[model samples]
Target: MILEHRTYTFKPGTVDKWMKKYEAEGLPIQKRHLNRFVGLYVSEIGVLHTTVLMWAYDSLADREARRQAMYADPDWQSFIAEIWALDAILQQDVMIMNPAPYSPPV
Candidate 1:
């Protein structure tokens, strides 16, 4: 299994707004398209304005396909457009990971 880890850093004080918007709109759209939704979290101690999202997929190809479909959705497109207009995001980091043999199933 492969895990997709996405971390987004928003401008100061804007993370809450972004999270609310995502929960109300983006989450639903992603839930429909993604196969294994892991979780979403915010950093409390280290990175104040950052949010982390985790997703599991059977393979890289599966991740790509699912993400492609989600991107093609009009609702998702519109939601992202609004996010971009907000200009809240400062940076984004994405990583594809593999669990260690001893790691528990995600």
Candidate 2:
């Protein structure tokens, strides 16, 4: 599986608002097109006022396709624009990583 991870840092004192907006709008849209949300989170440590959204896909191609579709969707564009104007600053990243190897019980 491919993991797409992003973290958003909300301005001080705006975490609640950010989470509310995400729950009401962002999550639904993501569920519609992505349908593969492993988890979404609000950090309680390190970057206390930040959020993380993780999604899993079958492969890199699948991830690209989902991203392209989300970008082309009008709802996503506007939703992002609204958040980009406030509650977020200098905190966004995407990383694709491979899972670490593990041995079965001997």
Candidate 3:
């Protein structure tokens, strides 16, 4: 499994708006249908007021395939466009990790 980190530089005061809209509209589609999100976080103290998204899958190929499918799908594309409208600039960085060793609440 790996995590996909998406950093969004939201316009001022857009966090609450984006968050509410995202949870209200976007999240249900992702969570119920795609199982596309594992975690989301915002920087409390950092250089970038970024939002990080973590996603888990069985393997890298599985991750790629799933995300690609989402990217291609019309519904996902529209939802992403809505999210993008909230950001000043957005960047994505993907990290592949080995988390099994330190997982499951030690």
In order, the Cα lDDT scores of the candidates are: 0.94, 0.78, 0.66
lDDT of 2 by residue, 1-106 (tens): 7677887776788888778888999888888888478888888878687888888887898888887898899999999999887745656777876555562211
Candidate 1 per-residue lDDT over residues 66-85, each given as its tens digit: 99999999999999999999
Off by over 4 Å in 3: 32-36
Tell me the deviation in Å of residue 27 in model 1: 0.5
Clash tally, candidates in order: 0, 0, 0
- The local lDDT score (0 to 100) that residue 87 gets in candidate 2 is 45
User: Which sections of candidate 1 miss by over 4 Å?
Assistant: none
lDDT of 3: 0.66
Candidates ranked, most accurate by TM-score first: 1, 2, 3
Span of ten consecutive residues with least summed lDDT in model 1: 97-106
Highest TM-score against the true fold, candidate: 1
True lDDT of residue 75, candidate 3: 77
- Candidate 3: residue 38 Cα off by (Å): 2.5
Worst 10 residues of 2 by lDDT: 97-106
Question: How would you encode candidate 3's per-residue C-alpha lDDT over 19-106 as one tens digit per residue?
Answer: 7777787776666444346777877787555676666666678767766776777877888898776664445565666566768521
